[model samples]
Target: MNKILLYFLLFVGIQSFSQELNCNLVINAQQTGNENFQVFTTLEKQLTEFVNNTTWTNKVFKPQERINCSMVITITNKSGDLYNGSIQVQSTRPVFGSTYSTPVYNVNDKNFSFRYQEFQNMVFNPNQFQSNLISVIAFHVYMILGVDADTFALKGGEAYFQQARTIVNYSQQEGFSGWKLEDGLQTRFALIETIQSQTYKEYRQVLYDYHREGMDQMYEDVKTAKKNVADAIIELEPMNNRRPNSYLMRTFFDAKADEIEQVFSDGPSVEITKLTSVLNKIAPIHAGKWRSIKF
Candidate 1:
């Protein structure tokens, strides 16, 4: 009976802590007129297994606690084993005391090019650069984890972001488009660098305040929550003044424009004249969305 009880406890423990990300990965190869659909299908199946099965962090998360995310890789061209494509990554977190899941990270990476063979094993090694495919996917995974953590706690995503930075460092020597500083202003290097820089510290703080302190409290006290959310947006104005039209700022609004519009469109009513103005100045491209916000 003692041995049986010990085995049962072990089983329970194993079941309790599972993989962190519940990612839905899709491989779209319609643009590649290759009649060999089997390769793409197999690649999708293996990648989906790799992403969903790999344990991303030291912290243990229950099944339901897993971060909800999606990755769509659109293969634009194929030449034998070489593939050129783009990847769209998006992640969301559930709001406290509510059924709604709020978008946290959403961006499209256009520099995804890699070599792959059908049924090739996809493995991730953080300490070393394995392949462009692995490094790119792992980098985005950490970014998703980092942003999600920031929403829950102030600077909570530091460790995850560092992991992403490590991947960037290791990948730079491989001459990939998104891994180096000269790749472009909006490359993966820039995204991680800007997020970790002390100059843009307020961005992380806004994430915590906007989500944990504001969105999480909506079900309990909506008026106070709206104010908190608005204050978080206002906090970005100083940062915007210092660094206008930043890549990070654009990335933030890309994931949040619709949600921000909806948040102020209908609520207990908080003063948003300044809020809309600040948003327009910082993110002029989103002015149309801001205009739709009801006063």
Candidate 2:
């Protein structure tokens, strides 16, 4: 009996140690002339600490049980931009395992200086500002072409995005100003705006292709899938509002939620199919100003 117990303990220890998340994370970092991507020595250490020490288990991730994350950074000194790179992560559980890998083939160069400056200013204390930026960048990559919500939310959302927002807002008050949103808004604002990928429109076509190729469609029910897509779109609108849009697309919503639900009908794919037909017969006129402010 004692021998059996000892063996069981060994098995558990092996499993725990083997439960590592591994992947390559490449940063498309570059610099101009003499300056280059200089990851603060501390920042590099903190990232290592996060992966090696955190309890990123099944509770933090659903549909999978363990996670392995790895990264490689490429810094170009002449251009001060991220030319290209990639990251890969995997998760495993007792009976299941999954992996996610993304290519940073394109890096939005909207805020090169500000971004690098932020990284330069970072220290080794695990401050909220530094932590959030890391998360924001990771989230951006995931948003651009990420297919796994479960992994993203579990791995980065709470630890980074939610906390990052607080840090960003705090950096703007009576005592702060260096971290400005304007400089990075073009590429970075998507997180704030919550825009869903426009790729969702291809759902039906993807379904047809899967059928043609003899692959299984994850959602067998069309209506249910549509509803889910709609919900996802609605969720994106609040975040999307932080960015500027075309004129016509800008007039409908009084609040972010209203804009998402009413104008877009909580679905990103539902384009305005009958805008001309709906407005053709009526002459546009401004309404009278409210005689009194009435709620």
Candidate 3:
């Protein structure tokens, strides 16, 4: 009897140790604009509702007491344009410490969920930073839009621009790190400036001509190709449903397209490439350095 009682006491002690304080965390719905406010308020409200109203783990301990928990909520208003969401009470309490461990989970970007290939043609037309991500963007657009590539292309224009602008702004601020927007922008800027620096201005003329005349056909061809790509991807959707999130079929198709396009791989003029290379070399120093220049 004493042994059983001892075991019971130990079980009760463990239960007591694990007992969580039930607390109400209220976040003003209007405070959604404030970054900190958004995160914390959403967390508290969602977690409270999740824990208090419903039972998560069905297996109960000997004494049948609720587990003690601590929660934190965070809200970021700056990111409100991109995401509006709440963090649920994301924690589990063992018979232990007071500190609540917050495991972070990312919100899925709407861009990622959309047809990416169609999204690309719209953003990359001017060959800006958005052009740098043409391949990946095309792949995503194809995957998400599936059969509705043309419709997705038409509707996704604004979203593609917004997302592209965001990425470009961020990369520029961060100094063109890695293969992101900053690097692409810097490369384009160097190419343009090198042409502009010449005494003859032939390079500049070529660029102007390329922009005005050459780009129209290029745009039409690329757009048409993208539409075809979208159609191809839509055909692959049944395969995705079969495999779920597998890009193998889409990638194979894209690779084939790229191989075909490689026929036009002959690059810009030797003089232009040389001057651009020089500009890019010195670009690092001039990237962040700004002095008042008289126009």
Separately for all candidates shown, the number of backbone clashes (residues 3 or more apart, or on different chains) is 0, 19, 17
* lDDT, candidates in the order shown: 0.86, 0.30, 0.28
Question: Highest lDDT: which candidate?
Answer: 1
> How many Å off is the CA of 113 in candidate 2?
6.1
Best by TM-score: 1
Evaluated at residue 271, the lDDT of candidate 2 is 33
lDDT of 2 at 204: 22
What ranges in model 2 sit over 4 Å off?
A: 1-23, 27-63, 66-74, 78-160, 169-178, 187-190, 193-223, 230-295
RMSD (CA, Å), each prediction: 8.4, 16.4, 25.9
Q: Which parts of model 1 have CA positions greater than 4 angstroms off?
A: 1-19
Pick the winner on lDDT between candidates 1 and 3: 1
What lDDT score goes with residue 283 in model 3?
27
Give one digit per residue, the lDDT tens place, for model 2 in 5-33. 12212111112122333433444443323
In candidate 3, which residue ranges exceed 4 Å CA deviation? Answer: 1-12, 15-47, 60-64, 78-295
Q: How much is the lDDT of residue 33 in candidate 1?
A: 79
